[model samples]
Target chain A: MRAAMKDGARGASMTPRGIAAPVLGGWSAASEGVPANVRTISLQAVKIRMRSVGNIQKITKAMKMVAASRLKGAQTKCEKSRAMVNPFVRLLGDTPGAETEQTLVVPVSSDKGLCGGINTAVVKYSQVLNAMTPGVTYNVIGDKARAQLTRMMPQQINNVIVDTTKQPLTFATASAIADQVVARNAPKTHIVYNRFASAISFKPSVATLMSNEELEKAAEEGVNEFDSYEIEGPDRSEFLLDLSEFKAGVMMYNAMLENNTSELGSRMQSMENSSKNASEMLAKLTLLYNRTRQAAITTELIEIISGASSLESKE
Target chain B: MSRAMMRLARRVVGKNASVPVRGASTQSRASIETFMKNFEQHKTSPTMEHPATSSTFASTPVTEDVKGTPEKMKLNFYLPHDAPFDKTEVDMVLVPATTGDFGVLPGHVPTVSQLRPGVVSVHVSDKDVQRYFVSGGFCFVHADSTTDICAVEAVPVEQLDPEAVKKGLAEHQAKFANAKDDVEKAHAQIGIDCCNAMVSAIEGK
Candidate 1:
């Protein structure tokens, strides 16, 4: 892939030479090793290359700034919301699981590219999940993951939610997605997303969202998990179901925020590295250009001195 | 009342900070452990007053079995998207449960009520009763008399304009009348029912 990309760039630079060579006899001169024009052409190409790389560095720097700011917002949100669901997290851990015939996999990814391996890691995790659990259907959020997953398991691609990352994450977004997942009425839903471990690290993890019937079935299995505290209210079963739905929304929203934070962090890290690489490449290119130009000048001077000496010898 | 709610929020935040997976402060964990111990002690004794806070520990002389001292319950009303009442204190709360419309008071039996789309009248103070139109959710009455209501969506009763409800009811009725299939009719009917409920809630009927 790298070689192909290099060739593509080389081909783009060669186009002007290819089109203008015959009219100007520039190709013939270059073939005969006329160092002046050759040096000029190479110098022009290197300068253009350096300028383009500098532009790319600027872009990556800007992206890093944007991602850094967005990551702060997402991190704050994740921190604020994590507390509300702590009890549920502990309860779900203690609860027994009942397997269903169908499983809905919600892959949380973002649409943007240049975020190194964020989408790829999620898609790969989903593939592993699909391999482990056959007959799993996919409800993809981001376009990048959807495209990859579609390629990997076309039959399982059930729905693809369009990109909404242009706007900040909101609970309404989560509810809209919850509505879709509920509409599908899948008993078992697994939200596969990148857990923001830190600014430098992320781990792809899965959280299960159970349907009302499944929760009822689990409740009937009677683990009696809420033994520590007494719960009072009528229609406990329906309340549990509603609580499950509400938790699902909260879970989805949390996942979205975490994934967004991870994406931003990844983008910021990758862009910082890329901008450094671009500048390094530019520095090397500039050094090479200067060396080649100096070499060309020396060759021209030697040619002139040798020509003068040969004329004096003939005299 | 708000102070108790703040303590609950502090506990939540403290717990979040103490989670080891995030590499948080172990100091916070010790504090949380103390809070949990206090919580467990309260749970085991089931007292009418909180021991830690002595300000509200005044003895209420109860003379009858049916009518106890009117104590207050911490009402934490949360929506999936936002918390309208983050562990606020209220004297009593009336909810329209699917089983039936019921009122919850201090020392009410531990129960979980599935709420319907209707008004939730919260008696915040002796003079102030805040009403909200809650779109279906759940209400949990804890053994310790702390009430938590999780609603899907809710708007303050005063925020629901009568003109908007009337317009929504008309549109839903038209959709219900013009529906070609049972599913569409059922969908429109739900809209109509919600709008009617909104109107009733706004009217304070």
Candidate 2:
């Protein structure tokens, strides 16, 4: 019984090592590299890989910092501009109007690249809208969006606006587009762009431009409840018109800002992932190089010993 | 008095004594002594007479000509979103360009200048003494005397502590002291220079 107990304890202790050896052996095999000329060659390759990975890490870190800074500025601009548009939106609600003849769709995007699926997502949503409402024209802003739209819906895109990188998209730009849309006799306009949800996430948002109908509905729903006030004649009409245009412009601009921020963040995350993958690849390469070098050294040792023993036997 | 004069005359005649005035009269020497006594009295007085003394001068009247001067200037400062609006009248806006400081005043010819990280001094109007510091941005001065400052970042000298700026400078200096590369040194120097300028501006020297 005592012997049996001792045997059981020994088995228990050996079990972990028995289980661990196969895993370690498999890892070593997976890490093994092709046999090469010199041990230092493998070592040097690993060192180079490590250095490259280090460089990638540095670049990713820098990109992250830049994205963070842009995100901060974008958030502040979006919030403030959104607040300014609230009153204008209310004025739109107070206006009395009906559906007009034509509708225009303005799709906002970035002139640059690196935001993963941001441009693609906006373009897809625009296509869906276009399908829903046939004969709706597109005013494309940003080179990437233009390119995508031109490829997918060549006839749908009416005009393309070039790079807008100097400052945050403003009401002035929106007004210019709005004027063009109005010239085309389009009574309604819609803005499509990415809405920044957080530092890491953003979603595509669509806002109606020409209809105070939604705003009116919102007001009726007590969405913008305040103390009762009165508005009169041409003053009220003029105010509503100006307010609607301004509100539409501000909303579009805010969307652009959010989209810009999302672009930066998405690019940053993608770059970070790339950097991480590069590191993992480098680590695997380094392990392989080390194993190959060790295996070469062991084989050489065995060969040298065998030759010495053969020489000794001959002597 | 005559005996004192005689003793002076005898002392002047000593072997090491300089030559005495032969043509001049004794009356002139007495007059010189009297003048010396008056000069000493003047030196001992609490105040001296001068033409440009503030007390002796009259304050200049504020003229309507100065008031009606058609100087139209606009000043805008770049600050954080939540920063309180501290109303300060600016006369001249000094922006830090890549090359050096670019100063602009009323009726400054329209120009756009590239900006860098440095202290931007906006000399307050009326009071030639007060100055505000801006960190970085471009300044656009229009022909209409509208000065627009679009800065990446700005902070008032009054808001920043001198000691903290000094410490920041010290750290930057230490970082660049043993730097092996030009890029590292340049970046570190930029921080050091900015912090040093902030400290100097805060001290108001």
Candidate 3:
């Protein structure tokens, strides 16, 4: 998927130039870096390549518009999900870190590509965490991140969840994931993902969630403001267990939703940039094609004039 | 889209299509309706019958610039995908605490209660009340008179369909009875509670 997406992104920007010189590589080197021996190419070949490049430009432009529209809907969904902050985080801000040595890392990205470096950033962050924390086992989500992480740390992966890109993230899917992670009994869980900051930017962040036992330990210690609040319900311990588990699910859902929106935004941004680059490349190609054609016509005209003059003088 | 809106959208489209296809077929529609009524009666078995049970959201950050006065309570109600109220001032907010039904009024003490599946009615004014039926979640009534109710699933009580509630309860009960594991049993219990609460809300029990 990554290779295919890279192929699509470089797109007409390279294929046309490749036609100009069948063996030349470093797609941007001859085309953009140096004003390329494009002038030496035959006029007919340049014209054919120009048409193909123009078509690519049109395709990229259309994709950009479609992504823009989809981004709007996705943005709203992400914004609403932002409201689902882990309630436990608010009430238990003073809760201590994990007592157990085990660490679970959940890297959230998507299966698809062409969304820029969001997935790579998340995967890289997970790798960094692995370096920092020993005894780390991964519960990676999204195929793109999972594949890369498995390649990087095959032995450490505890779970590999894919197909998250097929549809939107709902509470049901998120909670199921949460349940699996909790069942692993990792006292410390770090959810790594790109936090959607805007249409063009994302912040790589990791949210740390404590296991139910860890949370209960904190509450027992009475460090959190929650300890001070008057509880009126069923034996408080039962509620605490339920709350701890539910909050974990909510956190997982929120992180996935953020990643989902970030993907949309990143895809839109990259597409927009690609369309711009394609158009820029097209403009340069058109100019080169026209200049070469005009030069060819001029050379033909001069040869005819000189030959005719020489023939008259000889006569 | 909210559940009600999604249902309405689907129904509207269906009705529109039927109107164009079977132009002016009122007699046929009437007959089908009568058939549905009979089918519902036969489907509602006595043995499986269960009693009904009964239920904030975000406000506009009223306390963002200044502290909230003790006279008004700020309610922040959030569903996973929607925020029905954000920092909205209300007189009282009724929550179905797992401990029991509890009402938090302005100047109420700080409390955090695990919510049971029941009705939560918010009174914006003495005469105006908005009710919602929420699935099990949590409620945080802070010392600052700022309350946040984070529910897994919340639908306006008025928008719920009784037929769907009945269907859901039956499935919940079946799952509960058949569950071989503790986790599955607990999950089914949540479903049963949610459905039963919806039934109660609809029946005005």
Candidate 4:
């Protein structure tokens, strides 16, 4: 992914000549510093590599902190909003599943990488769902999912929305996505997302948002419960259709929130691990540096002693 | 005069934050009608004051146990950007539903109402009424006396300027008259409708 990102940036910028000069300048400076003995050069390379890794560790640590804070807010928001849909979820539960052959899959993932397995899980789940359903179309959100799914299930992907995981996912974003899904006119809509299980664990889960006909079928199955509330004015069919559309958008919003929380949680965990690895690598490199410096000093002393003995023999 | 109108028309197109789609406008129309009917159903009931205690929210499964009538309705209002109101209990809430205006009390029936661009008047008490301008969303009234209103964007009513609303209305009207295509005309129409509603809300109509 990093390689792809670098390539993408290079293509977009198209300023390789400007970037190459500074890079070559640094390389020349490094070469000028040493006589370039094989062992010394290897040691210098390790030091430079260690410094870069240390810098990366610092960046990951900061990213982890940011993700951790955002996860707290996203988790709470997702939980509260999920509560708001409880009654509707129950009402739909009684509704019979739609008999539609075609299904629309909404895979929720974030744009940023260094988050381990967040996008992969969503893509893998869609693959499973695609296999289960005969004809499946995908409406993918976020760049990460777009990249992965385009490779995994190229034929199924219909639309790809990038950069939706921008800071603060809002209701308008979800509504726009819902509009796109509605436009597709698929009878069964399934949202594949990562459910935030805990700070350390998350599992990809699927929620099915039923079509208008399916809701009516469910309402009929649970008539006693449905009749308890007085529906005011709109025709039953129209009301059901509108309700399904609205709830589907809200459901998508909730799924995005949950997926965001999981993404952050996974990012924080992965970053923490990477930072630890970096420090460990730094320690090992430092030890090698000490050992190599000592060996160089001892070799110089031996050469000096041998030169003095040859001089005494000549005298 | 036509030149001035044209200038205003250009400004209006730029000023309109979100261009409403044909489907949303039609859907809100249906919801407004239903909302009006709901308002009529509850109009005869006298307003009652209840003790105000805000509610906390969780994603727990809905309990099947029969719930006793509560004194006030618990509201959990969420906006996509940030929550304007979250799990706050209130005595009554008058929402501008897509169909019509209606109020929710502690024991209102379980129904779903889509929203249009209008004010959500939340009655926290007899004297404390908090109003918010909601840019289209949904209100779900649960059997457990919980009412949740979710929207794309919401701002406090006090924050809205009547002068701006008037200007917007004029500009949108000019655009509507001069629009060349059906799509452009429809966009201007949504702008007009929203601005008109904003004026009415600010005037306490």
Candidate 5:
């Protein structure tokens, strides 16, 4: 019943569009036959296009302002939360994970669109990583990434966590996602995200989160970074377990925040470019409008002069 | 003969000036031992000059001029929205750990401990100290004499309103009584606990 009601409402609202459809169709159809009538209708068309473009420019400019303000708040949150992850980074310094049979790629992104390929960058990077590595599965947060990854690699996706940006992103939200990654129990987990470089720039980056078992294996493989970090507690094994869990959570939180900040930054920059392009289009259209109006006036003057001369000649 | 005995005693506590126990129980430092001894003696004495100064001794850090003990710890207190204590240098910081309140001086051993809801006092000097009521986070004392407290939320002790805490505590109890589900009960219980902790923290002053 509700669906029918919605359809009825939409059908009721479609009258204006239905009425407009044939007039536009007829105008385009007539334009093809009567080439000489271009100048007369084009002025009205140019004016309409200019008005629409002007409205678009206004909307983009407003979006840019909103994004700029949100970017400031996001940057501060990103900076404040950076403190907890410093020690973790020092422990697990930005190194790619050891090659394992099974790996999990968790792509972090924001849900909203018009963010200048931040999500695309993450999806592309994850795809490349998945291709290069063997036995890789995907667990994605944010609907933006889920939709794109689902489209490209439907079989590879293991889990889809959506609405990550619906509320203010927090440690709890990140940890919930991180818990899903942990539950998969993949030997190697690589989190693909857009690292916030600056207000105008962001780079697609991968942060590796390892479980305690992987850490132990990595230690046997090479350098044991855990020994360097002095953990002064009784239960070393238990501490390692909790530390790794918290470690993954902290890393996830930081990565999610960085991705969020990058999304905002990308949105602002994209909107800025869009606003600029709109203004440029408006400038070009205005110039064309003026030139066409001048041409029409000049043609009218020439016709009047020629008619008067023919009259005088006849007289 | 005396240095060997000192070595034996030091081995019993910890290695290399690092106290295995909390800061309060470290009796190796003569300065700290004397500071506590004098306080005990003054508590029993009739002619105590300043009672207020002596009363708040547990929270306040008494810094003595010990050579090579720079005691200059940098505190980086972080909230999700702000970092008011970014690399702020202080003589000492008292972290409210899950175990208990422990003071972190310079050259302290590296340890990561979970924090409880309590006051973290950063002592700049004997006179100037800043206190924050941290709402449960992790406290990290690195080997580089930098202590970072990443609280879920923190506010200055002065900013907490006692009247609001009282009202909140009563409301939380009522909610706990009325809560039908386990999650709601747990939620109300958390609110009650936090408010109760705040009440004790305010009254403990």
Candidate 6:
């Protein structure tokens, strides 16, 4: 009876161990063993993924560097041009002359892509402007601008100008646009673009391009009666004309510079965010892997102890 | 007429008889002649003493003496950060215009001139001049005598490093000398020559 009881106890324990061993071992093997093939495949997949991420990082880094360099140049140009235009505008404001009947708004945007949402935001602002003032016509500068305007308010677009790819946004191009506007009898031309605020911030800005009438008014106001002795010949008139064009050109050039800087800043910020997200994902995956590995090791240790105790008791 | 003459002769003869002698009459006549000469001298002296004529001639010296003091002129000047002078008394802003050199002084006619890349001289009130090198752009002088210059690019000549300019010129020259094509060589040569000239001008050589 004693032998049978001992045997029954041993059998019960053995049965429990037997049942638990396979289950625990199987779990351990499945979790920890991760079959060499599966491990190889997973590691290969990780490596591929890591390689892709690295490539993305490289591209982003390159882009960031390029944007940084370009941003510096563009910012300088933008700032200098802004300084040039402000005085001219102030001159216009101070001039006591006849106001024009029409105001033309020239919206500058990029023909290309990768500088995200800047083109879209500029277009949206234009739409808002159009809504505020009915019958307002637009002179679009880039392909993206033309595309956005065409889809939303095709009728509002009076002229679509294709960019001179060689020059891009330049004084010459601005002059051409100004000339066209002047010829069309547009009284005042305003430029709309994204002004760079920071690496992640770009605010839309609008600047006025002085018209001939404004120039004339400035000249008239600038000419004092006491000093009328200084006003000579077609020289004053010629100066006024050149001043108007130069002011307009500078305005356009500055807008382009601001837009370029803002675009690069946006891209840099976006890339930095991407890099941060990638690192976060990598950390999560590594934690998951460690947990699965630890769980497998604990199961194997428990199984080994249980097996050792059961065999020793049977002996 | 004969009766009157006879009366005159009789009066003369009675007067002659009443006279003491010819010598006494001669003495009276000599005295009369002396009195006539004195009268002529008094008339000329009185004319010379007239206050209106003499005062007009004497007033010219006072008027001429008052105008001898020189009038002084004042001018105000503002210099850029890169410029040598912090502040100067400027009489005018002289810019190198594309058409020609132009000047802006107080009470100048309102004008606008296209500026080219060159040196700008600012004439000061003290007759001293400050010079700046400006790049291409335009300048506007208001009737209020406020002159505003919009330069496409501007840098003080002093700010440019002479050594760097020389090095750049040499490099550009070498590049041109070794160019495989005429077009490339021409472009490089132009750049080299420009740098060379700029360096020389800035160094005052």
Best TM-score goes to which candidate? 3
Query: Candidates' lDDT values, in order?
Result: 0.67, 0.55, 0.71, 0.68, 0.69, 0.55
Tens-digit lDDT track of model 5 for A1-315? 334323333433443334335435545765588665655675776677667667777777888898899999888887766666654544433334355688899898888787798898787767767655689899998989988888888998989888877788877777778888889988778887877879888766656666777676554544334454455443546655666777678778878888999999998998888778777767777787787678778977998999999999999
Pairs that clash in candidate 4: A95-A218, B31-B98, B31-B99, B32-B98, B32-B99, B32-B100, B33-B99
Which residue ranges in model 2 land beyond 4 Å of their true spot? A1-54, A93-101, A168-183, A211-241, B1-205
Top candidate by DockQ: 3
Model 3 chain A weakest 10-residue run by lDDT? A91-100
Name the lDDT of candidate 4. 0.68
Weakest lDDT window of 10 consecutive positions for candidate 1 chain A = A89-98
Instruction: Give the Cα error of residue A102 in candidate 2, in Å.
Output: 3.5
> How close to the true structure is residue A149 of candidate 4, measured as C-alpha lDDT?
83
TM-score of predicted chain B versus true chain B for each candidate? 0.65, 0.53, 0.64, 0.68, 0.63, 0.44
Score every model by TM-score. 0.68, 0.48, 0.77, 0.72, 0.71, 0.55
Q: Report how far off residue A272 is in candidate 4 (Å).
A: 2.9
Of candidates 5 and 3, the better by DockQ: 3
C-alpha lDDT (0 to 100) for residue A274 of candidate 5: 74
Return the number of clashes found in candidate 5.
0
The Cα error of candidate 1 at residue B92, in Å, is: 4.0
Question: Chain A TM-score, candidate 6?
Answer: 0.66
Residue pairs with colliding backbones in model 5 are none
Misplaced by over 4 Å in model 5 are A1-39, A91-95, A216-234, B1-69, B167-196
Full candidate order by DockQ, most accurate first? 3, 1, 5, 4, 6, 2
lDDT of each residue in A10-62, candidate 1, tens digit only: 53344333433442354357768776556477566666766776766677688
- Model 5 misses residue B58 by how many Å? 35
Task: List the candidates ranked by TM-score, beginning with the highest.
Answer: 3, 4, 5, 1, 6, 2
Best by lDDT: 3
